[model samples]
Target: MSDPFTFQMLVNYLIIGAGLMALGTLGFLSRRNMIVMFLSAEMMLQGTALTLVAFGRYHGNWTGQIFTIVILTVAACEASIALALILILFNRKSSLDVTLWNEIREPGQPAIVEDPAEAEATEPVPGVESYPVLTPAGIEPEHQTWTVHRD
Candidate 1:
């Protein structure tokens, strides 16, 4: 039996997948948060899935679909690992800002620092707020005298 979808439809699917991958790459390059990076990675995977599905449909075989299922499984595993890594990183610094981990570099390499002027000029994306900082409590209380012996 002849396939229901036209060649043009397959091309469209491929184009859409390419677009998704591009968008994900741009997002990955621009974002600093680990969560955002993971989301971008998922977007790229989604794009790949779309392309694979299109190929499977065009070839009249289950190969593409099977590959997509594998991709989904891998993506799930990747997401879980990423979540755990993010949680550990956040616990260490108590902040999701990736710059906190800049010290993780080659032994002899100097740390990379963002220029202050650029940092000041580039405002965070709208609606993206830094998490609130907990207020510092007062200093340790003094218990200078234990008068039990005298009493």
Candidate 2:
């Protein structure tokens, strides 16, 4: 059995994890692209997982490993949701830049149009609209639906 508080080894791992976390945070805060921000979030989670696993191994404890597994599950769900959002944003505006996504500023309000003429001149896409439509079954309002896996 190893001493979990071995100062030198613990300090080394902590420093490495802290550095990774700082870099991830910077990347997330400084980037406007949603994809880069999501990747940075993943990096932050990876750093956390590394720290958790290192502590688990050092202490011969299972709790940290279990926590790491929970983090992994959360990360998976986060990534899936972020990817779905990115696809939808891209489909709508043809850009993944977060700066371009200021359409909805208030709840229960239709997204603001960038140019009134553009909105009026163009024929609307079949399923795309300024507001999502509610279905009788309480499904995600139709305009908000995106095929997760379209053939």
List lDDT for all candidates, in order. Answer: 0.86, 0.79
Residue 24 local lDDT, model 2: 98
The predictions' CA RMSDs to the true structure, in order, are 9.6, 13.0
| lDDT of model number 1 | 0.86
Task: State residue 66's C-alpha deviation in candidate 1, in Å.
Answer: 0.5
TM-score of candidate 2 against the unseen true structure: 0.63
- Score residue 15 of candidate 1 by CA lDDT: 100
Worst 10 residues of 1 by lDDT: 142-151
The TM-score measured for candidate 1 stands at: 0.73
lDDT of 2 at 136: 60
Backbone clashes (count) for model 2: 0
TM-score of each: 0.73, 0.63
Task: Give the top-scoring candidate (lDDT).
Answer: 1
* Quality of model 2 by C-alpha lDDT: 0.79
